[model samples]
Target chain A: MTDIQININNKTYPTATQPSIANLKLSLNSNEFICLVGPSGCGKTTLLNIIAGLDNDYDGEILVGQQHTHPKIGYIFQNPRLLPWRTVRENIELVLGEHQSPDVIDALLEVMQLTQAQQVYPERLSLGMSRRVSIIRAFAIDPEVLLMDEPFVSLDAPTARQVRELLVKLWQQRPHTVLFVTHDLREAIALADRLIFLSASPMQAVSEIIVPIARSDRGNELAIESFRQQLLQNHPEIKQLL
Target chain B: MINLKRFLSTLSLLVFLGIWQGVAVYLNSNTLPTPEAVAKVFWLGCVSGQLPFHLGVTLLRLVVSFSVAMLLGCAIGIVLGRNKKLDAFFDNWLVIFLNIPALVTIILCYVWFGLVESAAILAVVINKLPNVIVTIREGTRALDQDLLDMARCYHFGKRKTLIHVIWPQLHPFVMGATRSGLALIWKIILVVELLGRSNGMGYQLHLFFQLFDVASILAYTVAFVAVIQLIELLILKPLDKKALRWRR
Candidate 1:
């Protein structure tokens, strides 16, 4: 993996209309699975959007590596955003572009654990299934950076745990630079190599913690619980949610 | 063997024809000739190639006018759908055009361009264009904004985005517009041909009306209506099903 560092320099917004992440500065490096954890309205999603180049209203220089090549980011949105008119496979292939093979399709479906539902339309799939499709679509492109904003926010508890484990496994396979944004401390602790905790709205990075657990330990509730408890004491807001 | 439902429907149609024949027999005049006599006149017109000639003329006009109008409408619709500023500028014009009486437009075209085939064709195009544009433009408006952003993030080129993203989303809208436009254009073309053109099914139907030949009039109407239904069922329906295959 090539070493890429993103620098957000003095990114500020007007007090009246600004989202959080105003005047926030952070740099992410190669092979970093960084999670941004914060309260709602903390501009976690806004930051992800800006980094993905979907939002350009910020005041900062976003650099990838040493140069300014517009970073190729795979963004898995909060909602699946699958075209209602496309089947599950076709929706995933939309990101893979045309000229994909049947093998690639079967592999992605298998990875996402959606092999049986490839031919099904988006409306027929459950919310969890649709979100899983969206994740695999993002990963299929093998983007330089993966930017996911609360990608599993809508799933039920057991389903969310399954998806969280799937995400960690996929992240391990590729080891691409990841900037995952979510409010769940357990989720952050489970998946992130490094966790960036942010304050309330008009947010700034309050603390940065490196997760010391092995990638294989992601789904172990006891190990994840220990880490969650540590994070809860440091960030009182996270404790309130727990 | 005919199904009972179909036979009953056929019987109703025959009863309606009998009432027409009875009325004509009671009048016993050239202005209200009997159905059998009108049927014979219609048969003679068909065999003598008069009806075919008129049908060919009307079909040629429909093909030329509908093709040009749909092409132009789809182009404008896609453009206006992609660009909000363009949609805002032309939306009012489309609304006014859809609201206008097709006959008034035909008369205006006749006066402006003279009593020519071009004038009649232009009238039919004008009547159909607004519906196509409105339907397609609305489809474009409902486009997935996030998918577009994903395409941008992936550096998908203009051609790729159109083929993969925009075209798939906008297809149903384009088809809906085309069907609605075709349905409107068929009737409007008849009026345009009757008032402005010197030949075509509509002109012949006008001739039959003047001579009070109801069977020939009905015969021409049935033939053209059947053609429209055939085009829709055989051509448009198949195309629609192929394009919407992803729909359950």
Candidate 2:
């Protein structure tokens, strides 16, 4: 487990004259779940893209530390982007290659209740199933820093909860830095160890607050609702921004 | 289900043969031979190995031209599809080539390169290349960016990404090109051979036509059509089934 430091000097989308991300500095402790909650179109995904090394146009440098020079990254986009032609198992095995044993896939599939669906192509899988397959794909890599950008947005509540539980289980099984992005504040409170609220205009982290509830109690709807109401009441600024 | 499909296919072919037989009988002329006469000629040609030889020659030409066109078209198409400026510049060139008549290309190739085997193959390849490039270009343009991002994030590298991600997405387009390539090339090869080549199915058919040997021409036509059907059954169909089993 290693802390990751991200320093974004600036980022200006070519189409837009003004910078979307400007001088945003963020630090993530090792083995911590950090949720980046923000308004819609706040460039949260772009920040994740920069961190995952997908977008090179951003003026930023992520320091993954000296001990581990080449840290592995796993990303889950807003949509389930599994290859339509690859089966669930093959999609997971794509990340493994010659690096890890096939047993990890088997174990993860078994845990995620996707063992039966492993041989099925992505098209045959329902939306919920496809989302689960993608989640398995991300965790199967055993990534050093997993960046998820609103993976649970379109899913129904029960399915989303199931997926969230599975994600938490996977995170508990491994020690890695997770940077989850979402627009929903309750979801952030339930999943994130520390919540980082992002402002829409300048697109930078505005405030950081620790989740007061324990991991076990996150499943309680009343507890989560009460916490959400109290946080919004205490900080009227965060409420409007959210 | 497979057995039923095969049965229906056999029935349709039988009905076709019956219709041809009826038509030829009604005509009762040297220009339209009966099925029995054509079948006898076909049998004799096969026993003597003349039909097989000409067929082998034409098949070799088709294979060569098809391979070259597909390879070059896929490469060029991928390049143009990825680069917008290059695609825009070459866009009109593709349209021009696509619109040019096959007869003109064949005649031009023979005139410029002389009546040689290479010229015949080049003429066929040039005729077929643009269609392949266009189909594959559309596929390349339609490639899912999200899947590509997934591949990049997973560190699949260039080779793995191509095989697993890019290739599968392009499979339909490649197959479309191949099937159409086979159909279009076989027909164009006949024209090319008729125009220039000394030996091939087309050359033999030309000889039969000049002699007014309707039975022999029909015999050779039957043999040619049978071979193409065999290729579809033995090679293309199985390949298609295997490659697209993942698709709904």
Candidate 3:
């Protein structure tokens, strides 16, 4: 928490007639995996987009450390959004931006367990495989902060659970500041060091719950459920939304 | 080990030829030659070197015209596809050219440029360019915006985005243009050559028509049709397969 990496101060986004996010304030520290949990249309995705610099039409001071400019962001969308013509390997290598070595790509593919699907195009890949590739593609660029928007929403339960565990493990090793967005409370409880839950339309920071469970405690279902129960008790609004 | 489907298709073709021969026999028509009569004239023409000379001339005209059309079409299509302003500017021009009859354009080319070889080829090129441009521009417009955003976020510069993203979408469109352009331009080239030029398969057909040699005309038509089918099978199909391997 001491190594503050990114700060968003009083960010307000106007879309159509309503403000998408109003007076939003949040800061992410280095190597901390923060989960943004909220109901549908909660501006969780919108906030993540702002941090990624995808939508710049917002009133805010988004600073990387003390700098006024936005940091280089790596984004993993809900849908993989992989190039259909490019093979899985080529898709991942795309993020390398021509300066990276073949070895770097090989290592990343190996980490993501996508070595076999290297020659396969995105359309050929299953939902889980494509999502894994998408995540690795985002991570490969070595971004300052990784922004994921319900990246595992399409996967089945078991696959999602496995991926969630793998993601935390990956974070533990390489340790980039992560802002993961999802609607699943169990998922939020499992991966998040701190979880920020937002209400429905015209969303604000409704509540922030710090999960006392360590990253190592992830994948222990009983511990995870207990943590979820504790969070529900502590944050009554989040409980009511669920 | 005889494949019934293959055997039946072949039998159908033979039966159709027999029926045509029967029609020729019944009508005793000078204009509509029988299969055997056409075969004889075709063999004779080939043996006498006349067919080869005319075939070469036709091939040359097609190659020239198709090449010009491909170059012009690809350049214009890509520009119109990528640039909105250019697309808007050229929208009416494309519509006008596309609607104008090929024969009308051919006559205009003849009137404008005289009986020159370039004139005939230019006619074919102009005839095919509009359709190619429209197809490719539509494909370019249908390109996925998400992939573009992904490339932007990764800071993939112009060259990389083009090669990786834009090219994949454009490749299919280009292949489509090539197929349609080749198909259309070849036939149009033949028409222009037959009407205006002194040499080519079309010119030979015209000469045969003057002599009332129906067999020779049939032979030339069959020969040209075979050439087109061969190009489709040998070149375009294989290229299409390679280009669209990702689809599989």
RMSD of each: 3.6, 2.3, 3.1
TM-scores vs. true structure, each candidate: 0.87, 0.93, 0.89
True contacts kept of each: 0.55, 0.91, 0.70
lDDT of 1 at A65: 62
lDDT per residue (tens digit) for residues B1-248 in model 2: 99999999999989998998899899889999989999999999989999899999999998899999999999898888878999999999999999999999999999999999999999999999999999999999999998888888889998998899888888889999998889899999999999898899989989998999999999998888889889989998998899889878
lDDT at B141, model 2: 96
CA lDDT, every model vs. true structure: 0.80, 0.88, 0.81
Query: Which model, 1 or 3, shows the larger DockQ?
Result: 3
* Count of clashing residue pairs in every prediction: 0, 0, 0
TM-score of chain A of each: 0.88, 0.95, 0.92
In candidate 3, the residue pairs with backbone N, CA or C atoms under 3 Å apart (3 or more residues apart, or in different chains) clash, namely: none
Which residues of candidate 1, in runs, are more than 4 Å off?
Answer: A1-16, A97-103, A235-242, B1-43
TM-score-sorted candidate list, best first: 2, 3, 1
Question: What is the per-residue lDDT of model 3 for residues B67-125, given as tens digits with 9 covering 90 to 100?
Answer: 77767776687779889899999999999999999999999999999999888888888
Identify the runs in model 3 with alpha carbons over 4 angstroms from their true place: A1-15, A56-61, A66-70, A240-242, B1-5, B82-85, B170-172
Candidate 1 lDDT tens digits, B32-130: 667677668668878999887988888888888889888898888889989988888888898899899988899999999999877888888888888
Residue-by-residue lDDT tens digits, candidate 1, A82-143: 87777888777767756655566677678779999998988888888888888888888878
Task: Specify the poorest-scoring 10-residue window by lDDT in model 3 chain A.
Answer: A2-11
Winning candidate number (TM-score): 2
TM-score winner between candidates 2 and 3: 2
